[model samples]
Target: MSSSAFKSSERKLEAQVKLNDYFQEFHEKFVETKQAFQVFKTKSFFYPDPDFIRTFTKSIKQIESEVKEMGGSLSRLIGNQLGTHTQKTVLNSMEDVKPESHVLHTVSDELTSEHADVLVKGTETESITPPVSEAGNDDEVLGSALVQEGNVKVVDVKKKLSSSEKKRGRKKFLGDNAVIPKRPRRSLMDEYVTAQNKMKSISEEPSTKEQEAEYEVQTIMDFKKSQGQYFYKVSWRGYSVEDNSWEPSSNLTGCEDLLLEFYKSRLKQQERTKTDDLNYQVMPHDANHQHILHKALFSHINNPTQKDYENSITLLASPKPPVLKSQKEIAELADKALSQKKKDRFYSVAKTLVENMIMKELTGKREKQLAELRTWERNMNSICSDPAKLAVENFVDLELPPMDFVYINECIAGEGVTIPSDPVVGCECTDCFTDHKSCCPNQMNSWFAYNKLGRLKVSLGTPIYECNKRCKCGPSCLNRVVQKGRNVGLSIFRTTNGRGWGVKAMENIKKDSLVTEYVGEIITSEEAERRGKIYDAQGCTYLFDLDYDKGDQNLYTIDAAKCGNVSHFINHSCDPNLLVFNVWVDCLDPDLPRLALFAAHDIKKGEELTFDYNSGLNSKQMAGRLPAQLTEQKEEGCFTPEKRKESRSELILKTPKGNRGLQYVLNVSIFHNVYQ
Candidate 1:
């Protein structure tokens, strides 16, 4: 043979080897898919998982592309050989073509199973066929074979199956016909691409519907009047601006506040010179205008009641500046603007200027209040030596820093109330719990309140008597925990629910750990009654009655409304994690015991800390043990702890003032043994 001919033969042999390798890979993938399906069939009575089917289908598509490429190469090779031989000789050669055992040998090497054996046995009895091209004559049959291992059976690639045989099962025969459908060669590639597109479309249809269904209006961005009808541009939550769309005003029924806000922003953006324009309106509708007028009037009425004053403060703290206009001024402006509808209306622009001035004043006040709160937080933190830090957050509303509310870590004697100034006798023991003799617990004639871990070892209602200032034990004394103050990180956050300010644990708190003392003005019971009535009328109470003696004549009370620690901000929960205990420290006066709060359970970080404001009182006991004002308030549906569920986190009570009138015997604080 000539050099060129020899080179051509070598190239053809290389192409054949490449084609064999591709076929062997495709065959192995097919075998694995079959085995997966078989296992799936055994495990489930139904069809295989859709995800598996999708993956297998993708593999099949890749193999089909490879098969098409191989077919094209084979067709070229056959055409080249045909140039030197007659059509009759080519047909004779194809008839004599045999199955390649090496392909099967390669497949067997990779897969070992009964399925592999069945496939290899079937291939031995079948002939491999090279696919016939569409351009080839109908009578011309090209043949070759892949004789390999597995349960997979092979049939003639060109064999025309009867309708009955086709209906028997959906078993796929490995050949060019299976990989690429029989069609006009011009449109074959286009059909495969179309099938893939159809599959993708079907798979993506549900997600598109889900996306449409999930679309929610996060806020109204802008509004426009088109042909006298309003259209608000709404931004959807969890999506970008690209997904925003304009919807008719009627479509946004429940989003009136958002619409009102958008209108307010638009009004703010308007030029000051346009105030005289009759069309310069604060709201799109008369009802919205009336709503704003009502709110402004109710919030800033002259000789305002306590509730009205509180409303004014809340509005003043609003992130958006209040546009305060008198009702009379609004009415006069509306009438003047309406009467001169046919002509140009001349409205005074002073109202806008007044609104701006008022906003500036309120903004200044809010800034000052916020600064005061920050200072208060700093001062409180400075008084503590604990590693835990205190943080404040208020995104709910512009609630000012509480007025006349003193942050005290220890109880202070109020008017008509007296706390003993003398220090309690000291414990000389090295380990108070180990050496119970002369220890604080021995002095109290009770068991040591804490175990080795510095957690409360006593039962829930036990009184804790810690080493006092005169104690021989050092500051590290485990029994000196409550006196040392809060060591756990805590955050004072403004609750979204109408429950006002609340405290949440910033770090995980173990069960029976000392949280904080409910320090406030210690008042006598007679004073608490007078204050409780006033608090009830004002819809708030901070009077915690010291009813530890369990007598009808309770002597003292801890009033925390204006004077308290971080405990004052703590809300009430139906399923409370905090329990109060009477803790005696520096002052051993039984009537003036310190109220301490302790973790009732292992509390997770970020979980809001709450104590039972009702002090675990049953309905009958509540009526008898609680203050008269509280009982009256309860009867009128103001203090209903029984109706609230733990899931709500904060107690849903009708009070602007946070505290639940009084605390009784069984409540607050953990006690630990001595470290001395």
Candidate 2:
């Protein structure tokens, strides 16, 4: 082959290679630009609000659909170019290479636009010059001539030529000599190539900002659903427009760790505030027991006695005489009874009648007293009030003491307060009645010995007695004998060893159990004080020893010493097993007042019964108020077990200095038997 031909062929091949490089570069840039746009569109769609997210997503989808169509066209154009390159490479060795003018024109038109905006004004329009044709009619000559110079080597050569030709064609077709306006100057490939490069850079860079924005938008959208609020302000790590500074965004939603930490801190603050509020209130007190006992004792003292009233009558004269001799005798006796002066006769006859009525009235009075005593006993026993059938009323239920501490014993009549004679038969040496003094001691054999006034005196180890009274052989006895009746007393007595004796219950008793009820005067603290002051003003000797506090001036007066009862044995303990309860003994019959003691804690069998003396008493009075004791450490300690135990031995008693002047003395012993 000739050297000139070979050189021409080599130049052609080089030009083709340059064109392929530029096309490949342009295609790559286009792909990069498309990818960057896709990322931007995706980021824009991620909005916080649900409504906004929907709108943005719709817009992005529309743009993406358009881009996909454009991509298909661009792909086909790239395929065509690649096919032309392949054909040239394979065919160039066997035949004279020819530049296909029609193919070149088509390719050029596709690569460049006819728009005048991209061209440089006044530059030579050589690209538009007519294509060189072969001199001979042979196809080989045309193909060889077109391929000879390899002038197609210029990058984007076809594009530049097509742009120039279109410009020239427009001017020629107008047929006017007028010069066309100068077009703007720009590099031939600047817009397309530059855009492609910018796109590649964008696609290469990480989509961090995009992803963050998308997450924020998602959080905001979910916030309305999860938090149920509108217009939430989101904060995160980003540049702030307001401060023109970079910092963490204030709003954080997706991170659960921070939210939980914030909530826990708030809860702790609330708890601390609540605790502070609770520290500023005061405690309460209970005083039901003392109130009831006071009422019972007071009622018994104030009630009027039967001896205080008079009982006599006189008759008017009659005109007719009696017919029967018996009637005449009765009439004569009646006249004799009524003959004395009005006042004098009334007194004499009433006195005679009272003495003669003793036996008959005694039986009736005894029965009446017994019935009333039993009723009073029942009231004293109950710790709580009965439940009402009506739902609207509220009742304070008393909590009772456990079983094994309360006992009831019958009362036996005595002489002028002396211990009554032995009512029970069957006696022997003291050994048979050891620790049962009621059967052995002649002085303390009666139940009446335990009764002081209307109250019963109870002591530790007091013996219970069984009465053995025989019925006289009279009408009543004969009737009882016919019925096979036995003569005996169900009453029991409390014994102190085999020596002293008192009344006691035969059966086991429960704590807070009702023992007996004593009736007395009931007065308020203020009333008692007023009465005390009145007594003092009247120069009554009994009021001289009364203790009065000027500030409160309240006092409690009891006839306890005179009317001591089994209820008196109950002692006070700091840590007591029994509770003294108060009840309005007769709300309907307020004249007969009473009080009761109930077991507050569990009581054991045979355990000395005790209660808290200062349970409801104010703290000021509790100190130094217990009974005196014989202890070694009296000066240093506030209280000793021995001293405390000694207080239980003290008995509360009444004196003549108005009931309020009474004091308690440690005459009775509680642990005497236990120690002995």
Candidate 3:
């Protein structure tokens, strides 16, 4: 019975009448607008009535727009009832062919012309009816119609087009000269390379003085020169932004007032930037780490118990009903589970639903956080995020304890430190690793034996000589140890021991590992002597004398007491794992060579790394390169094992004479620990 009633309503048609009524009212206004546009074009454009012309143009545009809209709706609302008439109209439109010449028309002109054509073409619309005889033909009819961006006219028809194509409507038939932006122009520069496109855009501008009635310019965007004459990029009062052109000063006379205002505004903007109060306005730092810091801050998690979490965004939105997306997914899972085969042993509907919901809550938040972190990683700038590239020489005072030294990458000039200017030593070794007979070994009997990884095989108390840049043996030379720079990880930390601060091995460092350069300002022997007196008063000293070759022409001292590398923090130790060595590379300047420290033994992870600092340069080291010792020099040094029994007799009762035996015992302990 319900189906029968729907069929009955179908025969007696409805719903379309509301659309027809709306279009009927709209069509009346459209006809009225078409007539008014004709009168204004003939009178208002030519006559000098600024306000009336504006009002007249506005009225015409509004009405034309309604009519165009009405045409589309009327076609849709009328449906099959007006099918024959629409088909005839489309056929007639096809007969009206397009012209070959290109026509570039603005919105205003297009609208004006459309209305004018409506008034003229009103009579021809009737004659377009398909003859009563041809109405039965299927191939010769258009049962559907299309409208453009509110352009309602049967102006074009292409047969055999799909329904979607017909609904999309037709474009204007343009000639070859039409500038349709089809594919993106890969390079306009390519086109400008030829002589043809080298156009003089403003060869001659319209001069207001010459043609005051025709010239029009409203405001200036930018300034330029054309053919040696000054011009402004002028936006005409009644035209679009695209219609702006480079008009000469003579042409912009009409808009001088506006042009003056533009310059004044620009000047004010400049002044605002220059103002002292705003000159240092905080902005995003150019460094990448600053940006990363900002992003990380915004994403910082706020705990529920924190004071700020009371106003937390998550808590604030919690009261709102949870979005139904998760529930929907859970329900879908329940349904899927219910349909699953019993043999497959799928979960029950209740279990599946509960699990799905639990999983959704868990995975959803995780997915969101992962997505955000991934976005942050992708957005991280190359320069700022990479710690290695970031040149942060100085440590933050709050995070690090007060160091009585400045931070510096390389050595600077000081009282006693003089930079070296010496000749170099070259090596003739083809492969320093395999061939122990390399020229480098012949020169100094290479202190360290190394593998391909440049780790030391055994610790030998000898001077280290590396291959220079002049060597043809290449960078992988075994003797080329210290100059390659510190490779193994190490950390500087404040010590619990009497030693104030020290360097620690972050990794298992092999015996004879090139730890770090003892970088500092190289001072002269005279300067070293003066600074020693000052350090004695201060109760601290970071000066090391270069006595490797003993009294050279230039006796130098490295004063890392003020500024230096990781090696500067290495505290002195009587039983040290690290040993100091004079490593020469780049320049074989024996006078002021680099002082590199190497592990004297296999240092374990987390072990304190130290070298004998105040100890005299004994063994192969040349003497007489040092200043007077500010160090507490013991009157009695360590004793031998043979003398221990006799030495103990003098030490048993805590006598001043027994102090030598105690010192001797301590020295022996240090010697054994270092060697072991």
Candidate 4:
């Protein structure tokens, strides 16, 4: 064969191979779509929700688009091998129709095994007769296989299917049924190419941004000015340099510190350049000039007393009268005069050097602190499962990190304190909330402490009885709230108002939503008293007494000063958003009840979390000052003791005495009553 003719035949074979690949892909996708629909139907029958319905609808639309894309690719591949007229006909027919409806079903029925061979290998005949269909009204689907005589001729392929030949759902004709013969197995090279094409298509598909929204700005890489506007090239955090983007200054709203630092460096560069240029211009080129000045300055700096000055003046007598004085004495007086004139300049340079050294030390310390805090932030979130992240921020001072502090998820038993790890008794109810009297809550003579939405319903100081490990209820049971851990997002940040470090809500929280459990070292009252004295002297404390009963000394106290969770940093407030409630899960000991903090009222994002430290939960003074809703719940009234115990010092992030007194809150709460 001639070179041109051979190339044309080669192209024809390649196109046929690609067409086979499209057919296989279309068949696979069709199966997936069918399976998805089947799953949707099953779910709807058992448990239906609007969200699932919307999701199914979305998936259907996406599948429809994907099918259309496959059809277009097939059309393009066929068009490359066939003549122009035939190509247009096939492309137009499949553009608006789905692959299953026309593309694959039609191809499968029309293209026989003999015809497929004829497509890959050229024929010698000039003119080819089209196959006759049993039904005269059969429609043309694709161009016929090419005849490779001296002149090529394309015939029309038709689909002759009657009503009885039609199929539905998964049983529809996929061009791979037993009735139709299979084409010869593809060559290894062709199969490899087909696999590569499939992978390329998959990689090109768009992905959802469910993992992360905004890319973190690692640092500003470069800055530029264009048309009176500044743009910063940002190096995205946790990404490579290739992903860096040029963002406008307005786009970097909260990066004021980064921007200012960049500008400061630029300013310093300009000043340094100016200084270098000034020095270069004034510097003398003469070999002896620098040596003479260095000698004079060194001499004057070492000693410039009255006697030396008088002697130098005497050596510099009038021209004819001082002929007796040596030339060395004259030069010495000139050196002394020059050094005296620049004495202030020497001192100024020395001062600048010292200031730069100090600034460098301070900058190094700040960077070190930042690195430590970033590490702490990573460690804290690594142990948490909540979607809301804990971020540490301190733009305050070079305050040293809290010493001997350890992050704990659960409370630790200290000296003379024991936590009940296993439950002795629990409800066997299938649904804890459904059978109230037979459930765990009934054991305490109390109803479930949380509602269906997991918000607290009982009044302040009421004990929360949550389902324990021994319960037959599932993880989603209505009675399980405090054991679920923190649901709302919180951040540990330094307050500008002298409050050392405090926790704040990162998202909106509803009233009575479970915030976080106050975890710390559980110690006896004696240990607490001994530690309290030391903490008081240090002007900081973390002792929270579990004094639930009135007119009684507390048996257990929680000290969060050293070993604690995020709640360790929570400060005290006169009117706080968070209220502490005694909660029981596995441990039913009333004296050692778990302290679960819940929101007192609705709280907005960025609000500080705090609780009353110097007063009891049942104190009338605090009750009167609290929100009306907190004090007057319909289910139960706030517990009031006949006589209140002395307020135990609460946990506070190490700050000055005046600053530690400032209170803030985290937006979180837990339900107090379960569903009926």
Best by TM-score: 4
Candidate 4 weakest ten by summed lDDT: 651-660
Please, what is the TM-score per model?
A: 0.40, 0.18, 0.33, 0.41
The residue-by-residue lDDT of candidate 1 on 1-676, one tens digit each, is 4558645654554465455445545544543454454445347423345455557545645654565455345435543443355433433343333223222223323332322222221111211113324123322222323222322244343565665564342124323322221211111111223333333443433432243355567898765677777677899999988999987665664565665566546444442444344453443443324454333322222233454444455565655636566667656554443333222222233333334334444666667767877886887678745556788766555666666777766788889777886775878888665565688867776546665556775544456788887778777776777877788989887886788899999999998798987878888878878888899998877777676653335687788888887888898876778877778887887667778888878899999998877654433323333343222233222231111112322221111113433333322111111111
**TM-score of structure candidate 1:** 0.40
Query: lDDT for model 4, on a 0 to 1 scale?
Result: 0.56
Q: Judged by lDDT relative to the true structure, which candidate is superior, 1 or 2?
A: 1
Q: What is the lDDT of residue 562 in candidate 3?
A: 74
Worst 10 residues of 3 by lDDT: 651-660
Residue 671's lDDT in candidate 1: 12
lDDT digits (tens) for residues 22-117 of candidate 3: 444454444444445454544644344545555765665565445544454443434343335643453234323321111111211233322223
- Residue range with the least summed lDDT across 10 consecutive positions in model 2: 388-397
Please give the distance, in angstroms, between residue 480's alpha carbon in candidate 2 and its true position after superposition.
61
lDDT for each candidate structure = 0.55, 0.31, 0.45, 0.56
Cα deviation in Å at residue 70, candidate 3?
73
List runs of model 2 lying over 4 Å from the truth.
1-50, 58-74, 81-201, 208-676
Please list the Cα RMSD from the true structure of every candidate, rounded to 1 decimal place. Answer: 27.1, 36.0, 26.3, 34.1
Q: What is the lDDT of residue 465 in candidate 4?
A: 84
lDDT of 4 by residue, 191-267 (tens): 23333344344334332222224567778656666676556789887898899988765466446555545544533
